[model samples]
Target chain A: MDETDRLIINSLQGNFPICDRPYLEVAQQLGISEDELLSRLQTMLDNRTLTRFGPMYDIQKLGGSFSLCAIRVPAERFEEVTEIVNAFPEVAHNYERDHEFNMWYVLATESPEQITHTNQAIEARTGLKVYNMPKIQEFFVGLHFQA
Target chain B: MDELDRKIITATQAGLPLVKKPYAALAEQLGIDSETVKQRLRNMLDKGQIRRIGAVPNHYKLGYMANAMSVWNVPDDKIKELGNQLGALPFVSHCYERPRFLPEWPYNLFAMLHGKSREEVADKVQQVVKLLGEYCVGYELLYSKQILKKTGLRLKAKD
Candidate 1:
C-alpha cells in the first residue's frame, strides 16, 4: 500500500457520502478523481486489505439476534470441536481464546429465540457446554483503525 | 422498513458493487430507479439501520495482529461512566456491559483492544487499568488463539 492507499483507508473507514454521486464527492474531498477512488477501493477489496466496501447494516434493528457464546474445549479436541461448532450457519465468527472457556464465537440468527435453538444444537453436536453471553448494553460500536 | 427497504437491504447486504454507477447498478438489478435506491439508502442511514456506507479494513492484516477482549469487573453503578471513557479510547474497538456469570465468570465490562503485538496490547491495558483504578476489581485478557470462522451477518433466506 502506498501513501494514497493509506489516505483512503484512514479517511473512509466510516464516513462515505450519502449523495447521488458519493464516490465523486469523496474523490473531490480526498483530492483524487472519482475513477481513481473507485479503482483503489476496488483493489483494496479484491486484495482483502479491506474486508468489504459498503454500508454497514444494524442486524439487530432488522429483527435479528446476536450473542457471544463460548465453549471449553479439551486440548486434544480443540480443532475438531471448532469445526463442529463452526459448521452451523448461524455461527458468524468463532475464536479460540486463552482461557478455560477456550472457544468463543458470535452467533447471528434471524430471531432472538433462534439463539437458544442453535445453542442446543451446538451442544448436542460437540457435547460441550455452551455459555451464551449476550450484550446487556452496548455503550459504543463505532471504531476506526487507521492503516 | 417496507418491502422496498427489505429488498434494498438484501441487495446491498453483501456490498455495493465495485462500479462507477454502483447505485444505478443496484437499481437495475432490483427493478427500481437510481433515485429511489439512493433515497432509501439515505433514509436507512438517517434511521440508524445503516451505520455507514464505506470500507471495512482487515485490522489483522493491517499489522494489528494482537487484539484482546479485555473484560473488567468494575462497579455496576460506575459502569456507564467508565465504559464511555474506555469507548473514547481510539484503540478500543468495542466497549459493552455484559452480565457476569457468578462463580465461573465475574467480569461485566468488556473492551476490545487492538495492537501490533501483545506488548503493545498490554501497554494499552495498563492505560485502561490506570483509568479504572480501584473500581476495576478484576479483569482478564481473552487473547484470541485463532479465528475459527469469520463471516458477516446472514439473513435466513438471503445471504
Candidate 2:
C-alpha cells in the first residue's frame, strides 16, 4: 500500500509493450532504473505480494474451448474429489465454494468434444456429476484491479 | 516468436518492476540485453499474446464488498448485440456466455457485477435487466464468497 506498491499495481494493469527491454521501458516511463525495477518485482514475488505474473490467453479465440464446472462434493470425500479433478492438466483452477455445488473448477481443452470427455472421466473417477457450464456469451472481458 | 519471447512472457505476467531500469534487470536474468527484452515485450503486446502488464488486486480487500456472477438467457440471435451493450457498462467485470447445462440450468450470458454491498450489486443487475430488455428469458445470480486461485497464464515452451 505504499507509493511503490501502487505504481507496481498501476503499471501491471496497463498495456506493456512487447519490446526487447520491456522492463527498462516501463522503468523509464516511471522514471526508475531497470535494475531497481527488476529487484523490486523479485522481492514482491518472493514475499508473496504477487501470486503470479504471466499471460492470460483468449482460449476460445485460440481455437481451444473451456467451461466453468461444478460438482456437489460431499465433505467426507472432498479431498478425494479434489485430487481426481486436479489431476488433469486441463483443470486450470479449482475452488471449494459454500454451496451444494461446492467444488468448482475450470477446464480448458482443445475442443468442445474434449470438454465432454473430460467431464465424463471426472464423473467416472469421482462418482459425481460435473456440471459443465460453457460460456454462451461474453459480457465483460478484462478485470484491472486498481491498487 | 522464439524461446526468448516465451520466457519473457512467463517472467513478467504479474507486473513489471518498479525501478528506474526494470528492463536492464530483466535482461540480466534472461542473459540478454535490456533492449532485447524491451523489444520482445512490445512485440507480444502487438501479437496479443499478453493482454496487459499491470497489478490485479483482490477486490474483496479493496472494500468492494459484494461480487455476483450474473447469468442471462438471451436468444441466440440477440446475444452479440446484448453482449456488446452489457460489456460497455462500468459495473460489469468478467462477462462471457457458456453452453447451457440443461435440466438444471438454462442461462447463457454471464457477467460479474461488483459493488460495495449486495444491495448495490442488485441495483447494477437491475440496470442490466433494463438495458437487456424483454429479450432475456431468465437470469440467475451467483455470489462469490471465496476466491481459490487467480493467476496468469503460462505459455508452453517449444522444445
Candidate 3:
C-alpha cells in the first residue's frame, strides 16, 4: 500500500463529519484536490482493495443482538450450506475456516429473540445445528488493518 | 431508507476528510448543511445502521504483539453465561459460541484474544480458564498470522 492507500485506510474507520463538501474537506487534510480524493476512493473500491466502505453501526447499542455462529458442515455439503447461510441479510459474513466447525458466519438481529428465531430457521433450512455464540464479553471492539 | 441516508453512508464509506470541519466540508460537496450531515450520522448510529465512527488502527503497526482465536467447550446450558463473562474481559477482543464439530472438533465457544506477546496471550487464556473452572471442558488457541481484510459492509450491490 502506498501513501494514498494508507491515508484512505486510516480515515475510513472514524466518524466523517456531516458536511456539504466532505470529500473536499478530506482532500484538504490529505493536501490534495477534492476531485483527486473522490476519484482515488472510487478506484480503490473498484479494485477491491477496500472490501467495503460504509458506516459500521454498533448493533448492540442500537437495541439489536448479534452473534458469531458456526457449523461443522459436511465437506460434501459445504457449498450448499454456504448458500443457505448466506441467504439471510442477518448473516453479514460467512467464511470457511480451517477448523472442524469449518463454516462460520455472523448474525446480527434486532433482538435476542430474533437471534434464536434465525438460528432455528437456519437449522431447519440447512439441517445443521446453528451454534449460537453470543458475545460473552467484549475484549476488543475494532480491527483496522494497516494498508 | 431515504436518499440522503444512502448518500451519507456512501460518502463516509468512500472516505471522510481529515480536516477541521470535516462535516461542513462534506456538506459543501453534497450541497447540504453540515448540521444535516451530522444529524443523519447521529440517526444512522442510533438506528444501528452503523456500529461506530472512529479510527481503526493497524494492531501490527501499534505492536499489539500477539493475537489468537481461542475456542472453549462449554455445556450448552452454561455457554451464554460463560460467553458473557469472557466477552467482558479487557484482553478478549472477539468472543462468540459456535456449534462443536464433534468427532472432528469439540470446542464451542470462541474468543479472539490479543496481547503484546504470545506469553501475554497465553497468560490471559489461563486467566479465562481459571474464571470458568470446570465449565470449560477444553480449549485451543489459534494465533493470527495475517489479516486478509477488516472493513465494514457495503449493504448494497452484494444483495
Candidate 4:
C-alpha cells in the first residue's frame, strides 16, 4: 500500500460522512479526486487490505449477545472439534492461538439465551467443555490501525 | 428498528455501496429516499446502535501481524481501577472484565495488544506488567496463530 492508501485507511477508520456527496467530501480532504479515492478504496478492498467499509453496528445495543468462548481441543482432535464448533451459525469469529486454550471464538447470538443454547450444543457435539467468558464490563473497544 | 431500518441494515451490512452517492444507492435498493436512509443511520448512530461508519482495516494486512490477547488475573476489588487504566493505554486496543472459571480458568481481565512484531508486542506487555506490578497475580499472552473464521455480525432475514 502507498502513502495515499495508508492515508485513506487511517482517515476513513471512523466518522465517515453521511451525505449525498460523502465520498466527494472525503476525497477533497485527502487532496485527491473522487475517482482516485474510490478507485484506491476499491483496490484495497479487492486485495483484502481493508476488510470492510461501513457502519459498525453494536450487537449488544441491537438486542444481541456477544461472548468470547474458548476450548482446549487436543491436538489429535483439533480439526474435528473445529468443524463441529464452526458449524454453528452463532460462532461469528474463531481463531487458533498458542495457549492451553488453543481455540477461541466469539459467539454472536440474536438473544442472550441463544448464547447458552449454542454453547451447550457445541459441547454436546464435540464432547469438549466450552469456556464462555462473556465480558462483565467493556472498558474500551475499536482500535484504529495506523497503516 | 423498523422494517425499513432492517432493510437498510441488511442491504449495507456487508458494506455500503462504493459509489459517489452510496446512501442514494441503498435507498433505491430499499425503495426508500436518500434522506430517510441517512436519517435512520444518523438515528442509529446517536442511539449507540452503530458505533461508527468507516473503513475497517485488516490489521494483519496493515503490518500489525503480532497480536496477543493478554489475559490477567488481578484482584477483583481493584478491577475497575486497573481496567480503566489499562484500557487508557495507547497500545491496548480492547480491554474488558470477564468472568473467571475457577480451578480451570482464572482470568478476569482481558486486554488485546497488536504490533508489527512479537518483540514489539512483548515490549508493550512489559508496560502492562509494570502498571499492574502488585495487583497482577498472573497473566498469559495468547497470540493468534490463525484465524479460523471472521465473518462479523450477520443479521439473518426477519421474514
i-RMSD per candidate, Å: 1.4, 4.1, 6.4, 1.4
Off by over 4 Å in 3: A76-80, A83-90, A125-127, B1-34, B42-159
Question: Could you tell me the lDDT of residue B89 within candidate 3?
Answer: 84
Query: Candidate 1, residue A11: CA error in Å?
Result: 1.2
Each prediction's TM-score against the native? 0.94, 0.76, 0.57, 0.94
Residue-level lDDT of model 1, residues A1-147, one tens digit each, is 999999999999887876667789899999999999999988888889998889898878878789999888999999899889988999999988999889989999878899999999999988988889999888888678888
Query: Which pairs of residues clash in candidate 1, taking residues 3 or more apart in a chain or in different chains?
Result: none
Which one is best on DockQ?
A: 4
Off by over 4 Å in 1: B156-159
Lowest summed lDDT over 10 consecutive residues: which window, candidate 4 chain B?
Answer: B150-159
List lDDT for all candidates, in order.
0.89, 0.72, 0.70, 0.91
Candidates by DockQ, descending order: 4, 1, 2, 3
Q: Each candidate: RMSD to true structure?
A: 1.8, 4.1, 6.9, 1.6
B1-159 per-residue lDDT for model 4 (tens digits): 878877877888889899999999999888889999999999999998899999999988988988899999999999999999999987788999999999788899999999999999999999999999999999999998898988877777688
lDDT of 4 by residue, A1-147 (tens): 989998999899999999999999999999999999989999999999999889998767777789999999999999999888888888999999999899999999878899999999998999999999999999988888889
Q: Please, what are the lDDT tens digits per residue for candidate 3 over residues A18-108? A: 4556666667887888777767766666666654444565546534577777687898998788788878877866666666667767777
Q: Tell me the TM-score of chain B in each candidate.
A: 0.93, 0.89, 0.86, 0.92
lDDT of 3 at B149: 26
- Candidate 2 lDDT over B1-159, as tens digits, reads 567876775566544555445677778878999888877766666677656555455566555778777878988888888988988888777878777767566777888888889898889889998998899798877776555544323444445
